[model samples]
Target: MAQTKQTRGACAFCGRQMTGNGMVKHLSACPKRKDTLGESNPKSGKEEKIYHLKIQDAWLNDFWLHLEIRSSATLKDLDSYLRSIWLECCGHLSQFSTKGHLGEEIAMDSEVSALFHPGLELTHIYDFGDSSETLIKVVGEREGTPLNEHPIYLMARNELPEVETCACGKPGAWLCMDCTESEDEVALLCEKHAKDEQHQDHNLMPIINSPRTGRCGYAGPADPPY
Candidate 1:
């Protein structure tokens, strides 16, 4: 397999950019996050188990996210979040299942507390046709007050992967769906060639920071939860 370029993303807590594994380590000991946790006002509810999950595009390793979610949240909550941030297009059906357990579909209502544990992995499939698959791993868990009232907290994400431009070799900002269908042609294009005679009539999609980019009707990511 060919190696993809390593990309770095900013920490949601401190805005410091780091590579995937580096972000994982940084999140575990992020001082800003620790301080925020310590400074939160005590609430009436008992502390709950907050799970740390690592989600990544199954085939595109460069697109990934680290999230902190309360065990009280349901699989449906995760599904919704994933759709909003990465996969929603045409209101398609999606499902979660044990990563290697064939045909074992996890219920959407299943609570995180019931389904997750350190090292456990699940696969999320969106849209039966032109599907986008994501691998979710239970990185670890901690007992703590729920961070805000949201079901999940964005912790870290991978920066957009770098892609080569068209045959012209200029910076690419658009993808031509028509050319994409032809095995011999390059689909990526710069602003100039994207409007050139050959590609002007082609179905063009903006090159955005998403695994679903250039697939189905995905335009770009929705706004971040934070």
Candidate 2:
């Protein structure tokens, strides 16, 4: 087995690529971001608030994203963005919930300004049966910017998860679900190898970009409609 490659991402401010944690550290010191942090308001004049968000798969920390968005935006906007970027597979229903208020779930139309604050954490569950849960935290908040008009802006994201290489050295593109008895012999195959007779009835699943991959009917989204 080869060593798994570390995940990397580009700084939204400088476009310099670094590890997930590295980008978090870099954003605090990014010169470009710093310059904007000092500016007061955008010409639009509507009061704005910048919210820093950290989102990750409830089951796997490797699939995650850091975002900067306007507090005025609605959960619907966030839902749309999330669907576009990762979770939209079968038009499943989703919702956000705070700790004790689980029964009082917030709908997609809920405004961020009304429900979120620094230090607040929420859970997002997509699809009721084969659900994909995401842990979300509102890490910071400040006066917003002209860029806030973008609804949702991606600041950083985890690099793709690492996996074993195929016999030919190509990265594994499929994982066979039928070989669970032999953990060491579990099949991780590239496209060409996946077509072999041994894998015909094994229920092959493609490795994909979303944390929802291999769950329910999710297979990642098309381009963002925004």
Best by TM-score: 1
TM-score of 1: 0.90
**Candidate 1 deviant stretches above 4 angstroms:** 1-3, 41-46, 182-185
Tell me the lDDT of model 1 at 194: 87
RMSD of each: 2.4, 3.8
lDDT of candidates 1 onward, in order: 0.83, 0.73
Worst window of 10 by summed lDDT in candidate 2: 217-226
What is the number of backbone collisions in each predicted candidate, taken in the order shown?
A: 0, 1
Instruction: Please provide the root mean square deviation of candidate 2 (C-alpha atoms, Å).
Output: 3.8
For model 1, how does the per-residue alpha-carbon lDDT over 3-53 read when each residue is reduced to its tens digit?
Answer: 267878899889999987678788889999898877655662458898999
- Predicted structure 1: lDDT: 0.83
Candidate 2 lDDT at 2 equals 26
Q: Model 1: which ten-residue window has the lowest total lDDT?
A: 37-46
